[model samples]
Target: MTKTARQLQEEGLLYDVFEQELTDIKDRTYGLVSELSRASYFDTEYVMSLVRKIVAKIGQDSYIVPPFRCDYGDHVFIGNNTYINYNCCFLDSAKVTIGDYVYMGPNCNIFTPCHPIHHELRKEKVTEYALPVTVGSHSWIGGDVVITPGVTIGENCVIGAGSVVTKDIPDNSIAVGNPCKVIRQVNDKDREYINSLILDDETKNSKYKQEHGYVYSAKDEAIFNIVKDTVHYVEILNKLSNSEIQRRRDFLRTFVAKLDEGAMINSPFYMEFANHLEMGVNSFINYDCIMLNNAMVKLGDNVLVGPKVSFYTAMHPIDAKQREQWLVYAKPITVEDNVWIGGSATILGGVTIGKNAIVGAGAVVTKDVEPNTIVVGNPARVLRKITAEDSKKYQEELAKQKDINKSEFDKMMAGQWYNAMDYSMLKLRQENNKKTEAYSRITINTLSYKDRMAKAIVKEFGENANIIPPFTCDYGCNVKVGNNTVINHSGVFLDTNEINIGKHALIGPKSGLYGAIHPFDVEARNEGIEKAKTINIGDGAWLGGKVTVVPGVSIGKHSVIGAGSVVTKDIPDDVVAVGNPCRVIRKITEDDKINPIRKK
Candidate 1:
């Protein structure tokens, strides 16, 4: 009979089963470790000779660790000074690399091979290869860690308990838990002291300790303590030697050379950039892989780009209309260094991606990306903070793969195959080709504010750029606008400068504008306030149908006025301005929208 949950819990059956199995595995793992440790130098040499032979067959740094086994070894590389503790397994049909001085705790598994998830194909064993997994040098992976395929863990990092490493981990960090996040940074203090001992030729650690005072602050002290405790706790691991330069050369020659050049491309690789192009680097007209210029991008490298994954400097726009603009403007975006583009991202034109910022993918960047931030989603929203440590880690991890032996690995990877012929060619040969077409309209419009203004009934409004109709403001270089605005009927707005509009504005249609407002003090205005106060628009403003707004007024973020109301005042947000002076009536509120009569 199937066991009931209650019965199983009361009898401790589940725990017993797990414990027994776990104990068995532990015992086996412990035995292996003891055997390796107790062996004499000659015996160790013999075991390694056998190990080398097996590794040659299964690939370098390959060992079975007793309880853990796999189907293939062609795609695995383990580095030196590493250990894989009890209950560790690897499904490495895909390439997997573990670097030097690394440790893996109990029950850790690295899965790199992939298969179709569809149930219909479950009976058929169909599979696809993915990118390799790389664990960089001097890393400590805690118990129950699951390293997925295509992940690269940077050097000198500490992964916390029960963590599932999904994305890439940068170097010199203390990261923890599922979807692992970097919580702290590694400093050079420890390394400096360690190196000093060698320089001083001190045999005893006590002498070295005596000479160095505790200069670290409280926070650093805490971090030091944690790292100290974790040092010996590391046990499980897999290892390999550094890849020779020839190998790296071979891989680059084969892989990078095959990449298509020019304005169109379709590859999936990441490119590291030189120091100079950080502020911005123009695209080579293709979107195959990422061009990483972390150092310069951090400082503000200007990168010019073309379409399709073309622009990625900042987060998506917040304004509804502006957000929609991304479909068209999400091209040729620019950014300064220290900027991060999240996965599957998009950015729009004529916008600057601020320094030290992150833009999450699938986001539609419409506005400027702020510096030193973390933004996410469709219209990217800022969620938290960022620091230089993130940048440091990125640099370290990127450098780890620098020494991979590409040539030898590649010779084994090559194969001959041909893809299916183009459908168009096939159809033509079969005399089966057919074509269909469709049509659509493209609309455009322009309006002049001043021309419309002469015909309006009411007058005596500020002659500022903000007076232009809402839609008409699109083309005006100098047109100033107000905050919380509702505009109607297209109008042309001419903007020079010093055009200021108030908040909570409402404007009307077909208004013609000549907003070259001069300073009230004639002589001073003649020189043209070279750096005049930009047109200011206050908040919570409303404009009447067919009304116009003049620039050079401060507008608040929230406020409302009447429709068809010609505004001249520097109206503030949340006030009810109307008529010529746009006299304040009553304050607007959510309750007013719900119950107008009651508010009145």
Candidate 2:
């Protein structure tokens, strides 16, 4: 008796991916995913209701952010109180189970499908197999992580950002890096460190106990009232539209201790103890940022806090007995002037990030960071120190700007603030839109027509450069594609500034290159003022599917960016990088030439 494709898949055997049974399931899941994506962002209750129809089982209080993608949604199960953040993809060809209290950061991909290593076998029939992936309870899976087939993460583990989990992780371990390895085990020292931040009796008596690193009762009458009042203000702030800039500012000033001039916090912000927070001049907090500011949380001048960045000032006793007793402590967090904290990065209590420091996306900073340093990883480590050369190089680049009477477009190209709503800029975009629309209308079968349309759209189109249909870009004339380059489907290039792609580049599907930036000042932003920075992709580079490259970034020659990575910093030549704030895992070597299939 012959077995069905679904039966073969369930048995963990290779099966035809395009089998009618499998395709039908995938088609159904895609429709549901699209419906969920279309749901209003603020409608949490409605979103959860739709989620129940998609996944096999989602326990109480398990919420998944919108714009999520998955294959075979019926095979996925999530436990209670689990929070899955934005743009997460779970390719659950087999069962994918997530345990309770798991926090999965943005752009994380859980892949269960495995294809044949041999190219011949893959091309012949499109056959593949799948294995289950399980993430344990009370674990933190950092943003942009890729969990490969058949992996099991044990309970209370911390899987760091940009890590590729190729194997099982032990319980209570802290693991990081590509092909992730356990760095340390969660021990009593972890709890002791938080406890050590508690103030002495003398200090606690003089200062506000909650703000001075003293353990305080969360349920205390005074503290509860403060929280209650703050919640009222926060809800109003979250509900306010982007156009209500002045109103939002007014509300913030009334509740927050110090709301300095030019400081802007985007809507959907969450905070506890609003009066304990302080913002310096020109500090910008992006959307969905959360501040558990039980203690004082301060941001110095010119700080750029990215989306989903969290400042955690509240902590509970590590001992189960004490935790049950509702014993909690709070510690202050400070970010000095000119700091840039990337998206999804978490700043723990008692951490003071010094001036001019960069906290990479998805980084979990636990300790104080020194000035002029760049940090990344789960337990964030100093990646490099900022040098004079960095300043010099940027100055040199800026000097190349032509000194003629500059228009708004000229200012935009020079990375200076300019009016994006200017008549000339609007005309250019309208023309560019027409070209893009025409290009999109042309079918793939007409290769010559498509090629001509692409050439007309970009500034310089090199020989043999191919871009699939459904391509999107803000301004096409600022883009330059090099020889023999291939950009896959659904590519979005926001070319408000220059986007230079070098020769022999492979850009995967659903990738985005964003070069636009808005002013930190709320007034300027509301006035339609904007700026842009150049994005450069070097020769022989490869960007994986769903990769997002932010403004002013450069991908060096012969480098490979893994799938689902959010690149926030420059990647040097000849390396493999991955994660939210993408970090280099290792340098490419000649030994990489050896293929396992050939060896077999």
Candidate 3:
């Protein structure tokens, strides 16, 4: 007869149970994790209730921050007055018991399940066993420490930051380093002063927390502002005509600490603290990498962080009371030389991925990865070592694909419709969006300011041609203006297709010129498929306010289009047109002939 999971567990014997049964309970814990991760920082009481529903036992006074994760919440127990910081992962396949008055710092990890050393057995998933972990009262586990299965930390012990404890530590001991060992023992005299200190003494002093660099320091504020500006600035640079390398360098100088020449990050990169970010020579980052570089995000030479790879550094306290005021701390993230991080991978705080390490796509890394290793999956584990031959193969594959990327980029610029999902095309679109945002932010009150803005985006910005304030367009580069053209304020130039304006043209306020036509079918619209046709306006043409010119439509030279007109078809030269689905009401009258439209 088969023994039940409870029976095997009681006997301390290895056993295999259906993974689906265990997963059902774990799924419920994930629901709670999601709620806590997204809950408002001020909802302290609500967050505590959610925690109580998960853990088998927790002290009444203790609280933890959001974004805490556990495999089986009921196996974990906490004592009174304990504090935990943000983004902690507790893999409690077995019991984890914490004593009272303990402090576990940010990004800490506690694991209690290990696979068999025999590869064949591990692959079969034949056996599983868990060992419980214990920490005595009044102990402090520093930031980024990792405690392996069954490690018993004794009373009044201090585990230094970044230590990996694989063995038990005795009472009154201070331990530090990988495969942690006891450093020194604290005697009764030391315990006297330590016990006298209270956690509230430093935290309750609001003025001290604000003034000192304890939270959101003065330097941090400065770095944040510069990061905001540069974040937008880099997007514009990415859209430049391939000759504006100097402008990119000038923008990079504003923030980016310790950057070497020849390094480039694709547009739409994200970061909050630029002063702590470092990049070495020739490192190229693809689009949309988020680096929360508060402590420091350091990248070594020849690193290639692919699109959507994110680096995190910020963390909040576990105690809901401390988290309520938005209290937080940070740790550094380091990526060494020749590392290739795959697309959509996330490297968290206090992680140092060593040189030549390759993180697989969509992996979520939590711990330090050794040099020349390949890791993949959630809570990423080492898959294999990367040999020198593997690096050569990777280079060859990328070299083969470089031509394909350049082909897509060229097709978009050549007026041919292409797939927007293509990497190079999206990069170009985001680049254009960035420039448009910057142009819109400026107050274009005068012709000089308008010219300054136009020069940045418009390819054929003619002499003395001015578009009034609040002009918007899909692609400014597609619009061309002849000499002495005046576009009035609040005009919408949908320039997905070519918009060619002759000399001495007058575009009235609140006018719209649309060139792109979308399909009526729902699937086509949802897929974002569209076609654009050119719009041409003749010399000395006058367009009145609230006029709408559809795609493939033209107004003849010296023609007059009246207010509230919708031009669906071409109008002949020297005619006056008005009204919906506009047609020529009459030939140019004496009044129209006498007052030809002139540049404002």
Using TM-score, give the best candidate's number.
Answer: 2
TM-score of each: 0.26, 0.64, 0.42
Write one digit per residue (lDDT tens) for candidate 2, span 513-559.
87877543334444556679999998878786657788899999878
Ten residues in sequence with the least summed lDDT for candidate 1: 433-442
Ranking of all candidate structures by their TM-score, best first: 2, 3, 1
Q: Which candidate should be chosen as best, given lDDT against the real structure?
A: 2
Residue by residue across 483-589, what tens digits does model 1's lDDT show?
33333323434332334444334343333232323222222222221112244554333333322344444545444444323344566655655443245666655
- Best of the two (1, 3) by TM-score: 3
- Count of backbone clashes, every candidate in sequence: 103, 1, 3
Candidate 3: list runs displaced more than 4 Å: 17-20, 187-600
Q: Residue 547 lDDT in model 2?
A: 71
The TM-score measured for candidate 2 stands at 0.64
